[model samples]
Target: MRTTKLIWTIVGAVTVVLLLAGVGIVAALRGGDDEPDPQAAPGPGAASALPAPPSATSPAPSPGADITGPLDLLVIGVDTRVSIPDWQPHADAIMVMHINEDLKSGYIYSLPRDLRVDVPAFDANGYGGGRRKLTEAMSSGAKVRGTDKADVAQGYELLAKTISDYTGVDGFDAGAILTFDGLSRLTDALGGVTLKIDQKVVSQHRRPDGTARKLRPGGGGYTGPQATYLPGTRTLTGWQAIDYARQRYTAGGDYTRQRHQRQLVRALLTKAMGAGLPADLTRAEAVLTALGDTLVVSGDRNAIEYAYALRDLDPSRLTLVGLPGDSVINNGRYIGEQLTPVGRGFLKAAAAGTPEAYLADHPKLINK
Candidate 1:
């Protein structure tokens, strides 16, 4: 799901598009033949308070290690200008999905962009030390690394490391990075999606003095006219959905924005799961050709295989897990957030393959 953004918000959309638009990517692949194994990891109350979540039954894989059975994917969405050639990207969202070998049910955990973290320094900048925001780890890592695709790769390198180090699960079995515009393009490729809205909100387009810049009242959006999101279910075009998910001026601010992004992905997943992409090679290739070079997915081939499996996965079996925390001022000046010990435990539970157990203790954290 998103950049400065709908953090961890776009995977559902990616799942929807790639499964439908890029046939060769998924058609030749198959879900793992392993049987579904949902043995409970240590319950939250029984677990020790480690720096991060302990691994599931099997030992955790080291960073970048490929493992059989259950898989954990660190999904990243970044803001980038890939066409510019020189415009490297920065992560807008960071989300992790953990699934059992059976590929039946999975947990999606969204880490906040402004959540304070201990960011490691790059060779160019040296060690950052002290506490920093989790969002800066990648940009800081890229600064020290090379400027070519190497830079983006370094960013992810640091990103995956930082997240794993913080969460304390074995390192990710696979990971993926997406440019921000990929959301809009992919959503458009899927036609449009219907999103469920809790409270109403208007698009976040304002002039210097904070006056409304758009008033088209629904339908097309982003580059041109758009409308306020009324409470209820509404069908949104690619841009309209993007605009709706991008809005942060409403009550919940970025949190609400994150929520909307998840809703958008859910809608897209609904569409993707309903499609017969495997049977429509011609249409898939056409869709991919139409959106040439707009989306760049890099890192972890295993992650792509997971996408292949996602084409047939049930959307209802997936759940979004939000990190609960209060906004705070870090180092007195920087805006950041932190979770309570139990909240961190919930995160640990999610990472450790026991979200259902953690949610049993903290039901409020579950997506309503």
Candidate 2:
């Protein structure tokens, strides 16, 4: 009897061990099936052992028409002020951006703020007739019409009509204008850009208490105010780079400022396509959102296609042209001188994508 009992006890122990082993195997299998492989889902927080699916859609790239045709973009920058009612938002900058679809080259035609032109009436006979600064079109419309929104829209329309009338670019549509605001946001989106400062520039900021806050100069010059100086070719944070671009009061004044703005844009493009920078999906999303608000992209598919074709463009091929200096006339009164006939011709060529022909016709305005 004792031997039989001992044998049964041993058998029971063996059964228990087998049961545990079976349970362990089942658990292992379930865990394997439940946990997804980290390598398979590499998205945000995936590196931290968290499983996340990558975003399905990327931001729509700039649009274009033919991959090898000439494209023109009208870029407008508005300067907003709190005071002066609704008409205070005026276009401080205007640029005709031309892209060579085939060569992947680009150029910016900067229109002078003081360029004189026939100011179109936004409303019916609000002002009988007048010639004024090109920049005043928006403000005049807003102030005179007493409807800021309508005036702003009319302002853009007038500008488009003027370009079309002068250049004869058949499709110079009013809807092609692209506008943006808040330089800080733009700079932040680009991570940081490199800028080459040809000369030393200093800008002073005024404090609320009437004290002057002077930014100290730094070596290599400075990309932004933090460094206080950005010299030749160096990398700069977004804010710093924006400051450089917006430095209008520098010794070189508006001309230098416009050139810097172009340079800053090129730098941003370079960094965007470069290596070493982390793939910042969040920042990219923010940028897209901001652009949506700031840019008034035309609905034209051709314009969209042209933007896409510029993806592989070389920055060096991009040229910058200031409005002809001689075309500017200060009458010492309200009326400003008109854009030079050569300058107007350049605009015509740019709009038509025949810059070479335009240059041949007006050699004097071409940058040597």
Candidate 3:
């Protein structure tokens, strides 16, 4: 009984971690661009790609093709550090949130950052296609000729195309870029997010004070007493949440980190919805204000419209999916990740707007 319980607990933790990478952001920014902030600087890699103001004339072509119903949104979490210029950022976490036609039920899953895929040719960023790790698509697409600055929006465009091709979807209805800095601010605005941990994780990146852990003299890993998170329910501050989400050195490595990230998403969404934040004008405004710094969104509808459309979406109804896969090591060289046949089939069902039907048969794929 004990062994069975532990196995299920781990499975549940992994399953719930990746849901709502975008939902939480959508819920938190429900107020949208009603009042723009001129003083707030755009997030790193956030440039002119932001949506233009509403116009009296016909709208231009959307950055991505719009889906009328059963939309798929590519949500990317980037480790965008502004401290270094000319540093092209990679998509640390890539997720697709599929909202069924009814908008009541949804499925969320992550594409391994190191997954091997053939990135399509994107002329906008001068990326001539080739097979590479999935994360490189964003780094290659974000580059601008004769400029050191990276365009995160362009990166997202290429990534969306890559994912669309990979999943056999026409195109994404919308997309969002979540930066580490923005996530922290959003969490703080919500007073802090509470999450359940099924296993103990020690931070290898940050100290207990949220500062960088020192490297050993020759440098293979950090040399210090690490910040430890024990198994239990814990409320994490903005930095703590981000730090926890960034941990990939645990037993499950990146997969474990992925689980924690989705868990963070679930926690954020729960806090945003249940805390009377929408009704509290002051807190709502604060959450919205923090959003400007948190997300770079692109879709036919603005942030407000997306939020409103999903307003009635029940967080409980969303399904957290775990795609099965294994690392690809070629000639003893660790290359990337690849989904098994079953995982690929699951993505097809998800793209076709029938994941629940598919999950009905393959119960193991459902994270819960």
Candidate 4:
């Protein structure tokens, strides 16, 4: 049987939004067959420790009602090893989703990982305020004194605050942390994603068979036969999808990677909404369990509940925004990235909830 509109209520707007950050809850709501079980909830404690919604004081909506928006959500993807004790993870990917008041459309944009900015002091970690790469905010904030384990939540808090300050946004209404492992599992859970590769890219980290390339002697870089992707539409497995999205050595550098990431999110959402997920009970269970294990959501409501509220959201309406930047240099050495004046203007417009207007004037910033 084909998935009906009812299942859409459970896989709604936030599904695409969360996909940008590698959070997977679509499988968590699936029933034994093609239809979704409305009563299903994500695994216990999947969402926790998040701030209340912007309208927390307002009367709560009745069951199955959509929530009002004009809200901002911050998403961070970190590549940290679980086996390594006291490991401090940096933000490998930082993206933001801004929802319009109409709740019908939204804008998604990425901040370059190497963008240099002022990271505020974190009392918990004794980090003094200083200029640093945007990626370092999370690592600096995650530091703990003595035997205290590294705190990812605290890291997220710092990263969100830094981004909010930089973008002129008052604050983020919701946030999520996506681990590297979760990303692979989520992609695999959906069977795979079919995306159009904009350009040819060669892997700098992996070999042809999807195994890790051997490290060069003395630790300069990986060495082996690399995987290469040609420009075209192709269905990618989890690892291939991630590797392709992570290519920064391409022509456009990090900007190209950012564009690919957004494209991957759109493809994943399109597949899920088209009822492309597996109908078998065993596969569905594995997807749900893997998603639950890797996702950490921060919001007033659980991810499943949030999905219901965003049910009317049309993923097709999302606009992918790219902020152009130039390399920051000092003493003839590249230090970091700095947004161009146009990029700054875009951020200002986004904070004012008028990104659509800004993009209309600066169509070049809109990613095709």
Candidate 5:
């Protein structure tokens, strides 16, 4: 009887252990499948520390074979006054980057910010609201629908939805909304990219006389702040490059400025991949670390795939095409306003994975 009792006790103990193990396994699976409960409220440091929240409306990741192929990314630069008090918050910068599966070739279609479109807003029912200025969706929504704060993430989502409505491109996700300051960190990470300012562009700095100090032209080796000022085909430091990209007060206004920004991007990509820089992994790590906090990205998988896809694109293959000159209305009110029809064509071309027609129609500005 004693032996039988002991046998039963051992069996009971084994069952308990197995039950606990099963419970743990079930918990792990549930955690993996479930999204974080939005009602759970983030901790004190969570707001600033966390990356932009994942798109609630984003589609599920594609299967392995479908992951590769042509991918379109809508990269939006949000100009929030609260974020940058010096500049007005506008959706002035828009680029649709198309990356092919082979990663050997890619194209960037830079859209004019003022191109009037039926700006889509996010309604309470999770649908889109009617049109307005492309830039106003975020600022206005933050004022009305949101808590009157600069919510860039929501703004991005609205833009993505609007683009989707205009262009029938399904699956093209809004990858990221990088602020202007983020450019500084990105350039720094690449160990300061080189850009040739092809014109005599003047940049004013703060002078001791309560005035601004101007930077004169010529090919000069520039890094950091000074690098940002040099114009017309010359090496520039990270900050300088960003400043060069941000300058819209040039003779051609925002249109010219957009061209310059695209040029700088091409130059930077060329420098980073060229044999000119030393193979210092430490510096690269530092640059990425500095940019880690400032840079905003969408899905991690998407970013990783894009990096791989763009690995083989040569500088020559990189076609930087601004919107057509005819599409722009240089009125006294808005210097670089984009016409809706032309803007629609540009977006459609971008969505269709071909922008050569648009580029062919637009004349390249002589690098000043």
Candidate 6:
């Protein structure tokens, strides 16, 4: 058990994250034209294209078709540091939000960043297929488009396409990419979030033996005296929340990190409802600007209407699950994660709007 309370960390800036965190930003601002630009690699048009919005009467397009009711928004959170010049980002956390037309029921799924995949060649990033982490798909796709020229929009398109292929789902209705900055600011703004940790966790990098050291814990940055999270519930600041979510050193590895993120998501949701952050446009905008400097967002009016319809949604209705997979160092080079049959079934079932049914038969992570 573990948790991180990152407000904006749940989704893109204020708009998308608010939607997933279960709030009222569905009435979008056209000014959001500033979203990142991503161009899909040639072919696999099925993977890169966004179809038109569906009518209220029509159900969302089947797995691969255009936007329809009961939409799935693939929100990919990239943990990149702007302080580093020309830092290529990887999709740190991949979350797909499935909401029904009524918005009464919703679900979230987190795809481990290190989940492995076979990436085809793209001229911009220059990769010719073999095996690569699922998180690498965006940057690889962006590279073919030109590092300087590549934008998050194109990155999202490629990543969405790849996820669709991996899960055998149709197209994703909307997609957005958030960053660690969002997580930090949201946590800070909310005055910290409370999450539960199942077991004592110490960084393999910093506190390998679950003992505190004169270090900054497992997370990469900062100068501090070791980061340690005792099992049970704890309230965390923005940066601390990010650090907690960054830990992937336990025997569970990435799975542990994924659970930490979900915990944060729930904490944020609880905070947002009580804190009224979304209703506070000024502070919310400032937080958005600080966290999501650049984001890729796509969707149609139909999706928006449903978002509006979900205004009074109860956070309890939200469901969280991880794709089924086993860690492996397949081939000599490929490493990290591989999908299991159960995971594929979950994805397929999720796309078909029946995740709870699958969960009824499977185990769920802590706080999910």
Per-model C-alpha RMSD: 14.5, 22.1, 13.0, 11.0, 18.9, 13.4
Worst 10 residues of 5 by lDDT: 1-10
Tens-digit lDDT string for candidate 1 (232-334): 8887776677777777778977777767766666667666546655556666665566557544444334334444444445556667766677778647775
Per model, state how many residue pairs clash: 5, 18, 3, 0, 15, 21
RMSD of 2: 22.1
Model 1: colliding residue pairs: 1-8, 1-9, 1-10, 3-92, 36-102
Write one digit per residue (lDDT tens) for candidate 6, span 55-85. Answer: 3353333222222346566667775655666
Between candidates 3 and 5, the lDDT winner: 3
Q: Write the per-residue lDDT of candidate 3 for residues 259-342, one digit (tens) a residue.
A: 777777767777777866545656666665665533333333454445445555566776777787899999999999999998
Worst 10 residues of 2 by lDDT: 1-10
How many pairs of residues collide in model 5?
15
**TM-score for each of the candidates:** 0.72, 0.62, 0.79, 0.81, 0.63, 0.70
Model 6 misplacement above 4 A: 1-15, 19-68, 120-130, 144-150, 203-224, 277-307, 331-334, 364-368
Q: Pick the candidate with the highest TM-score.
A: 4
Error of 5 at 236 (Å): 1.4
Q: For each candidate in the order shown, give its overall lDDT on alpha carbons.
A: 0.61, 0.49, 0.69, 0.71, 0.49, 0.60
List where candidate 5 sits over 4 angstroms from the true fold: 1-66, 83-89, 124-131, 141-146, 167-171, 204-231, 275-283, 295-302, 325-336, 340-346, 357-368
Q: How displaced is residue 329 in candidate 3, in Å?
A: 1.8
